[model samples]
Target: MADENAEETYDNFEKQAADQAANLVEQLLAALPEPETRNKPDGGLNPVEAARRQPAPQPGFDGTIASFAVNHDVLVPGLYLSRQDGDIATYDLRLVKPNQGGYFSMAAGHSLEHLLATWLRSSAYGRQVVYVGPMGCRTGFYILLRGMKQAAAVSLIREALQAAAAYNGAVPGTASTAECGHVAEHDPAGARQLAETAAALLKDWTAADLVYPA
Candidate 1:
């Protein structure tokens, strides 16, 4: 009887081992690749090689005063400050969007413009609010300076970014009749994100010589 009991125990162990092996095989088959396969290696082209062959997009115009012709019929070269009554010493921040066939809407760019301008003017660096508006080509904005020193805009940009990061104030001109285009209420979070990106870009900008007509 002891020998028969030992034989039964061995049989049980062998059955369990066989069951486990079958389960493992089933799992392996489930994880195996499908029979259908593509003939092309790497789906046709190598991603790294394709990327290396791709041409990069061209850069936008730098809007420098020197790029324009200064013929007698052309306007004199000077910085035009935004929203100023009569200031010839600064560059004007012109709104170049919202026109027919423009890329960005006037409403969207206007809100960001208002937030940036208001923040710059009210913050500790309010004095550096030279120009703040969109570009005509709907690509990006332009900032003209009373002086060529990049340091002039740096402080204000820093203050503005910190404020935006901790933004609590309403976007100016959104509710009042003085509204430029749109309000920051539409997307406060998105506005802050955009401000952070702009701040990062501004950090890399270096000041160059401010050349004016003599």
Candidate 2:
């Protein structure tokens, strides 16, 4: 009976997550800029030419971004080097499978972002840590570092996540309104849950695993 109830609950959760993901995708598509229009030789609207000549939405940027180019269908929960710009290396700390009906709630993602950022910024390799933040999709995080070797970066991520899983006391830097915009939205327990999950998935993870699955 207990197992049956648990299975039912899991099914409900999956349905809710799928529904929410679909809605978010809809909203994103709705917000995209319309393709620029062009006049045909006969003065009728020419959509094909318009789309081909549409200015890049972001200034000076051409072509699909690196993150979008990744084949999300095969991505799994693990650390990956998303890209590198000069000395900066951006690491994708994927905690959930992409579009798999599993995701971090906003509160959980918010809390984990704070915890991980605080810990990583003060770690031994802190000097090389450039930035730490969550992905918009709520599936993972991106950490940027400079002048750090792949092996060192791997160890750094493992240590930071382990610390987060074992963390106690107040979440760092969320003490007041000045420190955080949504102070009450944080869920430290949820953050710890996510950290533990990610840590387990990354157990025995090596620099070799940093490559995104082909």
Candidate 3:
């Protein structure tokens, strides 16, 4: 009887989670701004064309750091460019709160990583994708984009959080005996906790002193 009750509860949770995910996607789509349309003058160059014509000189401070420091820290988290290199950009996504213990069970982080990578690669904004992987410190994940002001990737972040909220469900690519190799397997409980924290952060994130390249 106890087992049966537990199974029933899990099923109900799955249903509720699916409904919530759909609602969140709707809200995000509604909040997105309409894209602007510009008429190109016959002789005037488009931004891309202008860029092609300019000499490949050193980038400004913000652009320089954003382009080269994929493996290095740019003092801030969310987004940054490396001052030393102008081609690398980074997207820092924290998986655990700072005050909380930094240790994430390997299973938990790895599982969450898989889910996030899958979602981001397939998201509408995937074209901007560069790299998606866990941070070396195990406290968070890093997503590198190909260009500056790559705010479009934030939508993928939102979708990842929604997917994380459905942690109880089976994670794709998680059950491979040969693939996982027992290197700290994925933990759904930990993934759910991290996901919730990330979701709250995203909702509250604003253009205050918190972001980079002010």
**lDDT sort, best first:** 2, 3, 1
Best of the candidates, lDDT = 2
The 0-to-1 C-alpha lDDT of every candidate, in the order given, reads: 0.53, 0.90, 0.64
Q: After superposition, how far is residue 119 of candidate 3 from its true place, in Å?
A: 0.9
Question: What TM-score does candidate 2 reach?
Answer: 0.71
Write model 1 residue lDDT over 132-197, tens digit each, in one string.
676555434555434334445545554565566567677667776556333433555555655665
- Any runs in candidate 2 off by more than 4 Å, and if so which? 1-62
- Please give, for residues 26-56, the per-residue lDDT of candidate 3 as tens digits: 9999999764445644345668976788878
With candidate 2 superimposed using the best TM-score fit, by how many Å does residue 81's alpha carbon deviate from the native? 0.5
Error of 1 at 67 (Å): 6.2
Report the CA-based lDDT of candidate 2 relative to the real structure.
0.90
List TM-score per model, in order.
Answer: 0.42, 0.71, 0.53
Compute the lDDT of residue 68 as modeled in candidate 1.
42
Tens-digit lDDT string for candidate 2 (73-124)? 9998899999999999999999889998778988888999999888988878
List candidate 3 stretches off by more than 4 Å: 1-88, 97-100, 181-184, 207-214
